[model samples]
Target chain A: MGIKQLAKLLADEAPECIKEVPLKSLQGRKIAIDASMSIYQFMIAVRQGGSNNPAAMLTNADGEPTSHVQGFFTRTIRYMSEGIKPVYVFDGKPPNIKSGELVKRREKREKAEKELAAAKEAGNIEEQDKQAKRLVRAGTKENNDCKKLLELMGIPVVNAPCEAEAEASALCKNGEVWAVGTEDMDALTFGCPVLLRKMTFAKSGKENIQQMNYKKAIEGLNLTHDQFVDLCILLGCDYCDSIKGIGPKKALAFIREYGCIEKILENLDRKKFTVPDDWVPNEKKAKEAEEKEEAEYDTDEEKEKTGKPKSDADEEDTEEEVVPIYVKARKLFNEHEVITNLDLKWKECQVEALTKYLVDEMGFNPDRVKSNIEKLQKAQKANTKPQSRMDSFFKPLPSKAGAKKPAKATVGSKRKANDTKGKKGAFFKKR
Target chain B: MFEARLTQGKIFKQLIEALKDLVQDANIDCSEDELSIQAMDSSHVSLVQVNLQAGGFDHFRCDRTISLGFNSTNMSKILKCAGNDDVITLKAEDTADALTLMFESPGQDRIADFELKLMDIDAEPLGIPDTEYQCTIRMPSGEFQRIIRDLQVLGDTCVISCTKEGVRFSVSGDLGTGNVLLRNNAAEKEEDQVIIEMEEPVELTFALRYLNFFTKATSLGGSVILSMSPEVPVVVEYPIEEFGHIKYYLAPKIDDDA
Candidate 1:
């Protein structure tokens, strides 16, 4: 959903921005994973699994189905075994701007479910199998169950204020964690210093994860991070619609020709792009200056849809929600509330407790659980220095970055990393 | 009009917790004597019936008969709101579309209320005729549940065989096979793994998932009764005190090779 044509564009324009590294090389790295995204990828794994019936998702004696539990358990353990410490960050209250996107996704899901049911009723196995993959969803119970299971496994789970990707990027930028592991291109738009894609590693080998080095990306594109975000929005982002005819190639050309988003929109032929009626360059500031309490983009449609009368709280809500789409998305990316400055520490694996939870509560096979636990226990017993703590874990990584990473990342970025010294110290302080 | 109250909320909590796995929405028939619900699972591979006599409730009144259709999942959620010691009262009118559940602490200090919107589910109670079985096994519900759970990891279906030797559960798949045999003893107050009475030795294979769902009711009693007839559905029952009971009927898995 994050500028669909962006990856292809990057492949063509900036090949140096992406690198396929061995999954094992990420060993001893403190990674903040997008929990919902990982859960979703695993759900699809079970849904489209060959031969195995999706309806036969693993469940307890009470018929409480848990599709996410099996996949997450295996993946988290896989990450841990590979010496990658996973700190899962879950999404919090969605930004009001994203509410429209969420509604559209929900409608699509409902329609897919209806179609799947109809296909099944018609005794069309092929169509049913195709629609089966479309109707999969990780519901609330599944999410809560995942949190509980991951907590019981002794991994740190953080609840972010708005978006998991943004929180993860903020942490990466602050040098609290090593990188953000997600399949989302939006993580790049959020300016994650390092974005990890193809994270479904346990199943797919070799290309465990593709690291998108943001510094290298910006250097190749010859644009600042802000400009990249504006370009992403112009191409198309989840928060708002893009100009009808504009795409990744055209958007890049526009950014290269014009200085920023404002200039391009100002110079565009209105008949082709169809910019929103009220939209203009820096429209937020203009609207606010015209009238102190004026809504920048009116919340009239949203209010009418919700059938709510105007109140003090409602007015403030509208005021916050009515900002220019790109401005709102950018602000959310910059000011996302995440758990940084907390003790980002890893505790030794409590194998016995993990084994007990898996066997007794989850109904996992005792021998299989024990075997996996044994592997982790053995690793913990032989724990080396570089892999032990969060701060010291990345000492060996910077040199690797110097060799193959961005040429600009060598000297000037050192001082930029040096600027995060106080923030890093705050993050590593023992709780 | 109908109003039923239970001083011990744990019983009501356990009842719904047991039925949740077997049925989605069930019509609870409240009459002059008892409350009963009989419904099949969506796949029709298993049927569950829950019975709670009027005598089991601390206070019960039914001016007229009513069928209250409630989703078991929502019912489980509401039961979670009540403390095990809290008294629970269910209030509903014959014509109303919603049922109110009131939970009051034993000291009457705190009370909470929830309204459950009822559905007019077009499901009629299934009429099950009593069947005399060739083999009947009475064993600790915990033991039976454990065996089913353990063997479940190995295969999708398990064969339950009751011969002169004992009661055996066997499952085999890509992971290899597992056989757990529970023999019987008559005179001992605490029998071995099971107590078996066989008019004729019988063996039947059934979907392990259905058997696992049946075990959700194991907490209702000390022991589970499995009455099986060759080529017929197995009847598994867990009896509650005061004539209340939860019963499951699971169709045997037809072996195509045989």
Candidate 2:
């Protein structure tokens, strides 16, 4: 559903932009991972018979299933051991427009649940296992548990105001993270400079992960970044239905030939072709805004601030007016919020509090927890040399938003700094 | 209160490798004269017994018979770091919840030591009855391992047809069908081939994966003895030289259960 077939099309067309890199080789780099995606993955692993009944998975003294806790704990330790400091970005409330996708997913899960019941009745063990995987859901409880565990492990958890991937991409664009780690290529459409996929240790038979460099992809497509987003929207995105008969290949050719979806729609047969209501021509004002030549001589800092997802900039101009829906979708991507000025400074682990959180409360084996903690300490001593990451965050943004200039970031004030950015009035009002 | 030292670390390493996959956790019972561990796989479909006499170790001492619970997989991982030539010592205080393992090279240089915490797992010992089986066939352990490995590609369950003639292992699935016949040959020069003793012909279908899992102990023994009766579980035994023996009992997969 995320720009259907976009990754496959890119794989075939722009092979050079995708480079395989080992997880260990990502040492000394900070990666922004989509936390909800990782939590959901671990939740599914727990649900679909993670050797659940026979051998208890990582639990605490209360014997509560800490699949997310264990997964985050182990993975954080493993990554930090390899010298890859991580900032886990979690999704906030989903965009209201994504209700359609959510409903569809729920229906699919319900259908799978019914199939699983039948499979269990029929004693089809294999079929039951497959169908059970679909019934798993990662809800608020799991997310909070993960946040606690990550904090215990001294990893930062960024709760995004919207999509985690969007927030991760935002972080990447700000040079706060080396890359965005997510399974979906939507980050590329959202303009993440670099995206990492399949960053798992026990992948079994999975092929090596390849990093997607966004700028290189645009170069390979021989189009501007805007045109590439338009291509993705044409191929279909989560926010809107794509134009009929326009897949990745057709969308690429149309953009190359006509330059944009609106232009391509103009030359098409009215009865034979179709696009989303917003994708079609809304009015002449939208067209006028397109030709208004953008401001020039942009430095890197300026570029970071103006990286206002395509949607934010367009919506800012047409605050009350309607534009193509893809413009709205792009604007939504632009408006999606991320944590900023975060004191992502990893701290020394508190084994006592960690033991209380995991072993005492959650019922994890105390011995295994102790052993893993020792491994973490060894990795920390041998690899991760502590340095200041807050310097870059506190360094004055000389170009824009001089209003919140605090000059320096105190560790205690980081929460306010992260949550205060992007519509503080609306955020508190809604809460 | 407890300490044991082995002349070579190879036995414990091999012991870990043998039962790591089948047994999740085990309770190692230590006494003055002998050390024993008895546990079953999580499903209770199989049981493993590891017995080591005090004489087997270079040094062994225990004031009281106490059980130490451990996760076998974790033990297996720790054992992987041991060198075959290293002399290993296991030490634990009476009230301690952790067991320390010290591995020293034969030359007394380069000593690596680590500790594993024990769990108070309430694992009860199952009383297994001794029953006379209709057939007991002894064959080279490698051959049995190979047969199971080869047929696992074909199906999940294999039928072990035992007759006065020999034992036949066969499996069929969507991939195709395969059959391996091991007829008794008294003149076989490999020491052990297919030795069959059948009161009457007995055929039982057992899960191939469990058999393959049980075969993880192939390094512990050179030959395998499979004993079966009309509808009973298949008893697979691997006899160790001076250490002890490990046995696995797998329930037959009934076609009716499908």
Candidate 3:
């Protein structure tokens, strides 16, 4: 039945009972939660106590675990107790392309943390001083515990290969989940069948709980899900950072008529559009490669028969093995460091050994290791073997004391001097 | 279960004004057609609960139970610029974390997008003792708001004395004393004032600020019902259509001198 018909049926005969639907109906439902979104919410609600400020220690003066615990459990339990079982997803390692964004964020947080520490040290307290507490609350054990508790409650959780919300949306499209529950509109672009707003325990008594069906919601936008996906790509999703000057409403208009990402790009009046330089297929390829590497590392096993060491060359033989660029990149950097430090020549076997060590001993994520190995391989490919400046630069120099000084040719020794002149010219010219 | 889309602006405007001054963070409990918010202030001196009926909104529709995480601050901001009469549409975005509050005014149109951020606010179960109150009074909401406003001018503390004769609200400060005494249906009064009498004497002191904020909310409705004991906090309740009731509780002032 359509949602309206169902809502009507329930509303007329059994309003009270329908409101109390068991949480199980939510099972396998995709919930798109912002990984970094609710940290401030926790800080504001969680009580503080003791020096360590452990999650368990966080309680009100009356000894009640305050809003943080309340917000987490009430919503989680309410959903579970009802039939709408949820798939709780968390974020995993981000692609390197996002490093710049991450770097900027880290810098901002560091500055804020420093100011907060200073304020506490100086004891210049104000209501705004809560901002300091907010920072400490940002990445804390309490939040992690909440996620863990949800998992222990038997909710399916995906450590999303990337953005938790985006991955959750993928699940929605796959029909693994009926709808996505989150506060972010970014999910709409991810193409979920339905997006539920105001779905919480707090507004349970309100007359109407607002829900939007994706098909109806996007009616005016006139864009198919694929086009909408491109719109988000243009606007920027976790996959690709957003293009400047494009937001939800504007991107919707652009993609609705264009029909596809390629059509929009082609039809765009050059003067009106400024595509971000970094928004290209290669960047997406790089990200995909990086994700492949991470997933491989998550499920890596060492085989016994290869006592001679299985190089990435062996990995290349595997059908699904996606070589990561970072693996080779790390080796190239290390080789540079070794050559610069010890003035040694590049050794292929040593690079391979380091890659193996990183994978086996260091327990580096295979995806990450593969990427670094690929980077080193690329560097090796770019340079001519044994002929590049790096190769000769790494060659050991003869020690001053070990070499005999050539006997100074007597100025009048014509026969020996003529032979030496030709030889010296040839060597010096080549150098 | 029952979905009606409200297109009138006045309803939204009135609703926003009614909700603005109340405590921003409160857990509203709802059952079927009834919704209530219960919260005590930091001092435990005052508590306020706002109730509204299911029919209060134009598009009142709910079949299944849902609890919304609403921030009074955000809602107030959205309601601020709304005209007294405007058409607004309220719709659920899905079974998720968003609600669309759309306003269509004469020259301007706007949509206030709100997402309920999950908060970890815990509600402790409070056991309220059931007792026979010494005094119960029904007063006109306008007069109540004025009494609170006037007493606030005197000082932070006020004494509310109710007797068989009438209800007396007085405040004494270094400057002077301010009192508003009204016998049941006395003289010419504003349409908003309707005074009632008590069967017995009940007197208590309370903070004026709490009283001021709490009583001002009575303006949203026609009248307020008050139940009180001399030593305990007062309970002020506003009953609205559709089984919605807003109640405020103000604790008695502790006598430092005594």
Candidate 4:
């Protein structure tokens, strides 16, 4: 997934970097949320009936799913009622390097679809429900519906060029947002200034939002920004496979000692670690290969187009060079394409229009929709004053014997409070 | 067209046997003077070069210079079909896609021919600079082979230290450490002597896995020569009788701890 179990690792090693804050403290602050991740969670969690008909999704009269709309609509109104400025960032086209992950997801969905049909034939209600949840994907239709709903609510929406977490982190880095709010731990690796988890809870007043400060985390771990990225890559990101024997603790130790993956790899005992066959290329060998390919530069297409006679060697040398995948992943984390100069202006909520779109067009209850719209209008009217900056509210908590103790409570609840059932590995049966 | 005849066919067979493990495919550049081959292993950590002068052949003729590309394993398989004392002739046209081999027994009563398919191998010629080494050691081929094989059992790498007094090969691993030292000795037979010539002392570490592969050429010569310098690849040379030699260039492993 995203730096597998990175939050736990950070909590155990650098608890001083994270702090628990009351949800009310986020008032008058701009938070950028990853819309695709939230929508996927809603599709997995929101269903019609409890035990008997778990496969029945919340749908309108035309039998189209309305669960994401219901969840996103209520969540947006809740944020507005708390005097919070929310900017929704939607995912764009995934990078080419993520094709392998996409293929795996597709294969899993197809297998689940077949299993679902068999369950339906056997009249096994529980099995059908499990298989149906495995098939839930936040595809184009759901994303478009969420975009339309956000625009109607007058919240600023950003279509990220790649991953939404990276773009949301960019927005936070540029000071346009106070923090990037998403459950994915890779927001830290994306270099977000402040990462807020448990922001999308279902009206839970007991659980406070967990805040992780990027600068403090780096200082506590005693690593540079580049070394932190290497640590995440080693802990297994989406782009490449990690070495067989390395886990989070060993990965952190190696980063601290060797300073980077290349050095760690050179000094590591191959007999002990048993590195992945195609994990990372030896730099010297890759350079020599590049030189050899450059010296024999003759394209088969050039021969065809220019009427030059093609030699047999041209066919043999046409195989492309192998560029290691981890290099691409590292580059992506360093420089993800986002709208750098953001003009995110939160506008007034169109009360009448939002009511009609939600209640009449989306088959929502008219009374509840009107009440939520009223709350949005009232909060906007009271927020006519300029919003406060993050630094004004957040003085780095004093590092005392008790300051680090608060992180354990928040991190412990944060781990168990992840109700997002559509987590990457949760759909498969554990071996 | 090109054709070359060799009286002792087994030499060619032994040459292929020495190279096939290190390189899969290579191009042999043939000139009026000699036949030369240069190729690096897939890992690029080691290189092998072979040079055979035309004067050493029983009969040699070449109108112009040409290059022949082949897979070493396939060439070795074809070479194995010849008898030990057979007269072997290699024939190929300028633009032919296959090389022709003919073998005749010593009595001239038995004759056989085989056609081996050629491949289009694209190899870049490396510019190997000729530099004077600091130390050169000449020892019996069997002694070098035994030392490499014995040290391989202890560790994956070997540190070679050469001085005016003698040369030492040392290795260490989880099991323990081992070292073998050889002093300068002049025996009655030239091949039995162990000689060391040095301008300055130099020590380098190399992966023993590749040295073990280089020892496959022990059957080609009575003695082996090792040339070493600082921050450079060591040259392991096995000289053939009067024709030329097969030299292996192995880059030393730089120990960051050292």
Candidate 5:
């Protein structure tokens, strides 16, 4: 759950921050798409049959999962036809801070696997369908498959150093893309200038493309970017545990009042909030030494079981540090590792190779592949012409700061104002 | 064990009604002397603190101090089951997961018992420093409620200015500006009096939205107290005769346009 209930909170509290734009409006924009998130969605949505049928994972002849390819291929074609240049960002190694969350996900997957087996044994179709969806994991294979597919289509694919969302946000910040496209709200926490949600939506006509303006959001909420990130962390993020009782509304209040997690934690009542035991960041060097000792001690048993050398085990142990999860989480949000100096160039789709790869290797229908290839070529041809927006014709002038300055200035002096106000004998300072 | 019985059960019911909309969950701290609660509204823009003295209850017993956390909405639902004249008895163990509420009708012919699940509410107990207000304006609770309600129609924020002459509540919106002034009126009925005691003049602006919510306590008191100092949160108090008072603290909106 990336910033749980964030969309609702934004809609409720800062309606001006989100815009519902028609798909056609994005005609000449480059969007850095979170590949893993979309792939996972495809795995859930694209099944063997319709919704009424058994939700079996769609696979190629050799049982290789092809649902992601099927969904991604069609979606890319749709986006291309709309003249939207898509840059797919794939996840590399996740940050060490995410290990706990990954472990929890793995445990959940295992439990779902067991439940699926039980449901299969019981012949409960509905239960099996539910468990199957829960078991979906976009692993390395899916990532590589999409990478190859996008490469064939000449759509740029960036393999992020840690997280795809961060990489996508970085690309947007670098002005390589107009927006970061994904359902995950954490991209905003990573400071993506613009975040587009429901971009992967099937044309059901029920939903509109939600464009969230980061600047407008912070301005409307009266928060600095750092404070916004703190609010996201408080709401709930993948890299660390959130305080149990604080929901979205309360989290925003805390962030607004205290400014940062450190100040909030400093002032929080432990009896009420129940801060975790290991809330502080651990000493890295000490933790590694301790883990290395444990690894050395476990070597005898490892040697007896798998003939693995003590040196190899020690090397593996050395890599795992005991940094407090939230600290690492915040660091990742602020300064995630990405290939910053990226040279992105969208080229003509290799139609022949794409058709052969999709139709022959992926077992896609030949006629459908051919038609999509044609559509892609048509979109590419249309995109080659210089697309000039209204702003491109004129030099942008400095925005009038008169209206915004007073609001910001007042916010800056609010704490001080309150402090002096409390000095007056009649004032009641309600905590 | 902890138990407190109130003869007028409607007070408890009305109290829940006043609090439920503003607060979602809170802990009711019961001691030998009094039962108290201190909670900030979900937005933290305002706070509601309640204090009910033990002596005011028909019967009160507390072997040890206990904190009972509950969802105010759920609490309201449970309280709604009691009749207005019912004698409400609240009981809980020293370390309880739920609080038991037993309500007996005045006729003693009907009785209802509700066990409300306790929540682990994580809220810091805010320390409210005592202050002698620069100005204290006391007016009929109904009148105060009407002013807040009427001003809400005019604007989002209400500007309240108190002077030696009288107190003024003013609001300006896109449509127009509205101002209501109340001078010191010593009516035959004490509750109808508009009384103001001031050392210095002060003007403050507050969000009328929250002030309107605070007015839900109008039925609980005959008069409402408005205490204020410059640049600080104004305290709105509704006294529950012989028992306690429900106080709301709302910070004034720092005028950015000013």
Candidate 6:
């Protein structure tokens, strides 16, 4: 079947799981986008319309940031208007297993970029020249402007420690988001319970939209979540390359019959199965490694207790653990007793400090400062009743003209009444 | 659906050349059994029509009828590319907006796809005149090509005069007049130069560029025939194998000095 037909079938099979929600609700819901994937799709589509630089990075005459800025603002605003709040996650250090793919992609892009630069410098002024520029700009802008636009929209962007999509899938698994949105089918294997396939253009068409229920998907394959993980591992994941001669269907069958990784490995014929040299079972070896690691840890702790110099490895480790002083200070301030007592962690430290310093150093009453902090924090948290609070806080002291005078006007008589019995004194007070 | 045939590649080649020169508004028609195209120059005084028959292609085989809807400008662009001596195939793919042309030669094969765009060229209302006081001249394609080539050296205007005895092509400019004459069947006459004349004489002036373009059609045929009335349009026709003919119409120049 074609991609469209497959998409239709998937959509039909998974209706309730893929039911459309108001874009507003999707706001604050984490979306895991395959950065390179989405940008490439956009580039291809735009080029089909014969744009001069369909992927061209745009710049003003002065050569400031151009193409990416426009794409980011325009596309993000479009998404926002459609009620899909977007958080653009950018890729960082790729895992070692993907190094080969990264090298190939880098070489290809470098060649393209060099050609584009030459075209620009030559002043060709042809349509193809414009197209080359567009392609280059599209790539550069994909990284820079897309991130900035998300920030401007008040969306939370995460620079993943590794593959952004994988991190995003983890976010969904941890209930930090409603679903993980990406075009890659591999995201399901990454353990996202709700994998939204066409989140980017879902609003535009019902045809391409596909939603997979991770639970249902796993059930359909007749494998538990762990078995599914093993299936992907057997099929080759970034954590370990796929075992040769094993594909998705075969891997599923292997996992289903064996029930565990150890059993599957045991059942495999030794001659037929050649494990990759780097295919270390880090998770399986974790317990025994921890015990051996703990024994080494004791020697380090002993070195810390005594005044002896730490081993070279230990010193290297401490150097790694050294925290920047500003971070330390921020942590201290966050846990400060005064800040904690008043529940003002969410307030700006500058604002809180100014109010406290004014009250303490300028002889402002403690009660008044406390009340003001409460009112300010409340107003900041929820934007209601600010005017009333302002009026009350700034109201003038009672005027002398409106003060009531003492009824008897005799200090000696007051002293005699104070000396009288408690019952008579209480009655006088009531009267 | 329409089809037409040509024996030598020259007819098709010259037709393409002429179409390239004419503005796209000159609607040319083609059919399976016959092909005809007629158009007038800017002055509307001359009308040219080119016709070809199916039997001209007896050595080859083509039976399908196809009609092409094209803007003349675009059609010219599509036809400008012709491989020498290769049988060109033109077909419209089932209701598609495009037409495909294929050219085949040893180790060299090419297919050009052109989208057929519709044009709105109104047919000229002026009919071919039935003037009796006229002249007809037959001459070798090379002789006409040579005179046009020489006149182009002077400038972009030339005069043609035909009489019972001979035909004269002359161009004059700041440099001086350049003239060429072909008398009936002289001793130096080659088999290629055949001159024909009528009882009366006819003379007319035309733009060098139009004549230059008109002669290009001769590349597809051996010779061209000139039919004229003094102030009327000139009809240049090419006779190919069997009774097939391709014609072109060009208006006469209005004499400002007169």
Across all candidates, the chain A TM-score values are 0.79, 0.76, 0.47, 0.82, 0.81, 0.49
User: What TM-score do all the candidates reach, one by one?
Assistant: 0.51, 0.50, 0.35, 0.53, 0.53, 0.34
Number of colliding residue pairs in model 1: 0
Better structure of 4 and 6 per TM-score = 4
Candidates in descending TM-score order: 4, 5, 1, 2, 3, 6
Native contact recovery (fnat) for each candidate is 0.00, 0.00, 0.00, 0.00, 0.02, 0.00
How do the residues A32-136 of candidate 4 rate in per-residue lDDT, one tens digit apiece? Answer: 999998998899888877676655778877878889999898888788777678899999887666666777889999999999999999989999999999999
Candidate 1 regions off by >4 Å? Answer: A47-55, A202-204, A277-322, A387-431, B1-258
Assess candidate 4 and give its lDDT: 0.78
Error of 5 at B125 (Å): 49
Docking class of 3: incorrect
DockQ of each: 0.00, 0.01, 0.00, 0.00, 0.01, 0.00
Q: State the iRMSD of every prediction, in order shown.
A: 31.0, 27.6, 44.6, 30.9, 21.4, 53.6
Kindly give the stretch of ten consecutive residues in candidate 2 chain A with the minimal lDDT sum. A422-431
| Residues A28-130, model 1: lDDT tens digits | 6779999988777766665333453434456665766555787777778778777677889887877766766788898988888898889878876667766
Q: State the lDDT at B90 in candidate 4.
A: 89
Off by over 4 Å in 3: A1-431, B1-22, B28-30, B93-95, B104-120, B125-132, B186-193, B241-243, B255-258
For model 3, residues B1-258, the per-residue Cα lDDT tens digits are 223344555544554455456455444433345444555443233455555565665556655443334556666666665555656654442233334566656555654433333221223224344566778777777778888887777776777888876888988876889988877774464444555656578887776776677765664567787787766667777665343566666656543210
Off by over 4 Å in 2: A46-64, A204-207, A276-322, A383-431, B1-258
- Model 5 chain B lDDT-worst window of ten: B249-258
Query: Between which residue pairs do clashes occur in model 5?
Result: A272-B122
Model 1, position A355: C-alpha lDDT score: 73
Model 4 chain B: weakest 10-residue lDDT segment is B249-258
